[model samples]
Target: MALCDIGLIGLGTMGSALSLNIAEKGFDIAVWNRRTKVTHAFKAEAGELADKIIATETYEELIAALKSPRAIILMVPAGGPVDDQIAQLRPLLDPEDMIIDAGNANFHNTRTRAASGEPFIGIGVSGGEDGARHGPSIMGGGPKESWDSVAHILEAISAKYEGQPCATWMGPDGAGHFVKAVHNGIEYADMQMIAEVYGIMRDGMGMDAAAIGGVFEAWNKGPLQSYLIEISGEVAKAIDPKTGGAMLDAIVDAAGQKGTGRWTAIEAQHLAAPVPAIEAAVAARNLSSRRDARALGEELFGAAPKHLPHETLSIDTLEQALIAGKILCYAQGFVMLSAASEEFQWSLPLPAIAEVWREGCIIRSAMLNDMSEALTEDPERNLMFAPYFSDHLKKNHGALRQVVAQAALHGLAAPALLSGLSYFDTMRTARGTANMIQGQRDFFGRHSFVHIDGSEGQHGPWAD
Candidate 1:
């Protein structure tokens, strides 16, 4: 049997989508899942191309079907299950056999896993359900030779967003997962920012879901246009089917996280980098999950502070705030990614990464295209100094500040958006209060000052 170039071990949403991509590309695909029914489900769902995908009943059969020196892609859940699957495969496969873990496994775990006897690559995939079905942003970190062997297939399957391939090599040994972890950390912040927009629009500005959705649709046509905003519009318009209502009962208020976002925050803490927006987003999700605490707080503290009843907010104004908040959220995310790249020595191409996210990924945006262009032209260019971003922040920081103040006045939590904006403001403002301490240190510790003598290095007294 010709060695099967593609084998997928999971048939979940991501795995299935990837399998389709592979099969569509004319690669012979052998798919197996731990749960037998998932394979059956895949068979049922996969029309016409079903015969090309062989469902395996046993691990040995699956391995045998792939032939020698097999290249298998594991799209299973991260952590222990991945370990277990690898253990089973190691004994059955040869040294040249390759495995790619495409799930969002922890980078530390991925590094440790790669250190095992068998050769494997940790790949991080983004662009959630839709990205899976169509294409997704793929990041891989492993042996250069291993990456080379699979690069062609990876590119074929990955989603092309913003005129760049969604798949890229993020250097060796866990870098891909690390970058993806940061991607997800940014994703959390982005989601929270959208939620804040909704809250402010509904509770503060009194815009209906359709109106909010309409604003988002228009925002999609501009520089702030993005996949997230487009989806937000659809979600805003989604109504409860049963009750003929605007509320979606299918989605619970309690959001359960898969721990990657928390891991990103934890990693940031370890790196001695501030990820306030991401951290705040994670905290907000946790707070949402803690229903008992919320109820208790309400009971113990009595009625919450009141804001003006929902009033109609202009679509134009809402769109502007959305744009500003989106920029801030991305800015913070990129900063965190930059910090991580520096700390981990990944040497990631920021602009290239941004380009991939512009099309197929959930966070795909016109802003990312600009980001991609800026960073591609100069890899070392920090986003804070990017001309477009700087100009946008300069023009809209005032509006963001006002929105944040108004949200706070109404007791709405907008930590991600607000923190990101604050970060941007701090980065840009030359004489802002944020750097007062640094200036004070220059005056006291370094004895460097804007001197009255009008010379290069003149002194200024701190106690004066």
Candidate 2:
């Protein structure tokens, strides 16, 4: 029997799809699952691609089936399961054989694993099951040699934007996962901003699911066009089979998360990076999960959300506002990435990050294509300041301000939008209220303050 080109353990949803993707790309793959039946079932269901798959019942067989100096991808859950798999595989494999952890791992864990002197690499894979089976953006981080060893296969199977594959080496150690975390953070903000717009349509405009879906469908053709917006339209337009009503209407309002967004917010705080849009998105999701609290609060406060006056806002204005919010959210995410790049010494490629995101990922959008060019011109500058994006903001932020203000007036909770507007406002202000904060801190904690006139650490007069 020919040795498999690569091996994948944990034949879960992503694993099964990715294995098929590998096999479909003409690479032989050895696969294993904890349960013997799952492994066989995957091979059995693989159709013609089953010819390229070697299903193994045991770790020994899984390891033996791969070529010498083998690389195996672990699709297990992040944290302990990944560590457990690595520990088990370490003894069975040679020092040169690499283990690739491909789950939504915490970057810190990836860093620790890479530093353990083992042949390990961590890659962040984005896109859901369908993308896994066809193509998904792949962000790789580890020793350059480890990434180089597998780059061909990764690029071969990854999603592409205008023929450029969306798989590339991020940097050493946990850079891939760090970029992925930021990707997810932006995804959170993107989704929240969309939801907020949807809420305005649903509650404020008195539009039903179909009408709201129509609005999203129209927006999909414009600057806001993206996977999330297109899918939102599809979701809104879908009809319930069990009931005659809209499928989206039947769904619960609460959203579920897998902790990646929360991780992004936590990591941003650690880096002293201001990602308020992402932070607000995470907070909104947390708040949404508290259905009972929200309901009780609604009852106590007498249901603050009411239908807006007919002339209050337009779908066109909402689209422009969403455009502005998206720019701000992505700007904050890139700044956070820049901060993390410095703190981690990774020298991450900001333009490549945007390039990869232009296709496969949830946040993929036409806007990112412009962003790639803008960042290539100057990666150090904040994205909002980039001429292309700055031009867009100048055209759109008025609509954003109006939407945020109206949302507030109507008692709508547009946290992510509000945060973006606040961040944008703060960024444009050269001298602000922070001097008052500095004085207060000096008065209470003697932290001292610096004056604009080239003075260093001076005590406040309040100390007397």
Candidate 3:
């Protein structure tokens, strides 16, 4: 039997697509799955590419099929499954053999697993099902030396932005996964902001799904052009065949998450980074899930007020607000990434990360091209402080403020947008109301407040 260049464990949708893509690139691949039937099915469906694939029945067979200094990519579920697979593969593999975990596992776990004896690579793969079959953005994090072993294969299967591959070696021990988590967090905020804008168009302007979809289509041609906006437009226009109503209207309002967004929020809190927009998005999802509470609240406190007249809303203003909200969301995510980089001593290359996200991923946008350039120009500065984006915020924040104010007055739920506006406003303020909060804390709990001149241990007197 011919030796395979790489071995892959898992024949799920993502794994199968990725293996086909790699096989098409002319690399011999050995594949294994927990269920033997899955491997058989994959080989049967491989068609002309079957010649490049070797389907193995056991872990030992999978390891034995690979070439010297073997490499295996694991596409299992995150957390415990990843560790279990590592334990099983450890004794079968040599010290130089490499194992890459390509799931959405927590970065901390990746770090811990890498510290073990195995030559582990923690990679974050994005771009969903279609992208996996064609091209995905690949972020690899592990020992720098291990990257060279699989870099060519990764670059071959990754998406390209302006002829450049959307794959890069990020940093050692979890940096890739950390960045991927932040990407998902920003995705959550982006989705929530879009939903909020759609709500405004639906309720405030009294537009139907088709009309709202037209707005999203128009936005996709401009600065806000992105995968999310494009899909939102498609989703808005989809009609339910049974009910003959908008598909979105027929579906449940509740959104589901698989923990990446929550992980990002928790990490932000630990790092002291203000990710209000991301947190608000997560909270909004939780709130959406509490249907009984919402219904009860409506009965007790009365339903939300009727939307304002259509004349009160402007599509241009809505677009501006969305752009601003997206900026805030990305800013917060990047801030968390920066904090994590410092805490972990990863020295993450921010520009390269942004560059890889330019295409293939769910958050792929034209804005990332601008971000990549901005970071390249000033590597140390936060994105909001960049001249291009600062100027954009200066011009667009008014629209965000106006939209947020209108939403409040109309009793519309725009939590993510409102949080974005608030975060931007707070960041720009020189002297915030936090001093009063400090004073209150000092008076009640003797927590101590800092003086204006930088003196510490100052307490405020309380009136009993």
Candidate 4:
């Protein structure tokens, strides 16, 4: 008897990789793709394994192959296409059938999709194709009862990082994708910061890519070690056959991003959360990818700032600089999430979220150990106020400043990471320019402002 537990729609890179992971875990899979040829090809590739994988070109056939009130995941591009597919599937699917939107769909859309009176899960699957094939970070948001129904299959497909499956039912409504979206936003900023480090090392310090990679590898052994740093070291060492040197030189400087990263920044802005790094990350990608940015700048301002060489940085100095930037990256990601959780009423658990990412997510860092310890002691403690982290940030602010200064000296952009660090520092301080900004808000909008003086200031008039 063909025993299929999960039905996968769309076998593109993500879908195909995830299918492999699920099937390898001893679960039957029913597969379908809009392009029948692709489905046929996947069927051919499955061979004897194909027996377990029932392939169908039609949604009805795919639904027919599933177990009663079946569980299905849609890996299609989110937006109108997802809605169209869901509309088609709704009639065929029973009321109790479960549908997981496993793509990078906006949580807003996830919320809307979930309102259909059926169990709809908005899942944020991070780690890309490799993560799907191996283990990736998974964030699910929906009814708890629905998660109870389908979580076993989710756990099987998720990669274990730090002894826990990198999968969590984040919260209600759109919380899962919201977390995932923000995770990608953080990822964008994190990648840019690492790339800037590479630029500084290669261009400013007169080091080769391999040399930079070597330093990154060394750093990975210490408190700064992370998946990003680990990958950075390998990327730096990757040489071009033609140049017999770093392939980074041959690769285009432009970075492409799906809308999730940009969407995160926009949502941050909407919620009045200061997600400078994520915003900077998105803007940096846009700037880097635009060949005409300089032309546009020249058109507007007549001349763009010329790129300058950075102050010479010793290996030790560069490492210190990296330490600061890396710390700032994690700090910003968490801060944004914390602020968002508050805005959305998700009441997300930070330490658990950090723990899940320890092995699987791209931003997993050695600093997570500190964060995890902090969270474990006080799971509800807002991390910004955590004493140990506060001390670490206070002690390290100088290094972060130095990194930002050095990047600026080279006329390079390090906005997101640097801004995030700045925000973290501003928030941690009991008194700072940020307080002044808050005070002004109260003066203007009649919003109450808390003073360090333990007195509430009356609103409604500035002259008073």
Tell me, what's the RMSD of every candidate?
A: 4.2, 0.8, 1.5, 3.3
Clashes of each: 3, 0, 0, 2
Give each model a TM-score: 0.88, 0.99, 0.97, 0.89
What ranges in model 2 sit over 4 Å off? none
Kindly indicate the candidate among 1 and 4 with the higher TM-score: 4
Model 4 gets an lDDT of 0.78
**1 or 3, greater by lDDT:** 3
What is the C-alpha lDDT profile of model 1 across 150-250, one tens digit per residue?
89888887887534578888777898898888888888888888888777776676668888788778777876666777788888888978777676435
Which residue pairs does candidate 2 place in steric collision?
Answer: none
Better of 2 and 3 by TM-score: 2
Worst 10 residues of 2 by lDDT: 454-463
Ranking according to TM-score, highest score first: 2, 3, 4, 1
Error of 2 at 455 (Å): 0.3
Q: Write the per-residue lDDT of candidate 4 for residues 281-379, one digit (tens) a residue.
A: 889889888867767876887542333344445556556655655556566667677777888788887777787676566676677778878877886
**Cα deviation of 62, candidate 1, in Å:** 1.6
- Per-residue lDDT for 366-432 in model 3, tens only? 8999999998998778798898899889889999999999989988889999999999988988999
Residue 102 shift from truth in candidate 2, angstroms = 0.3
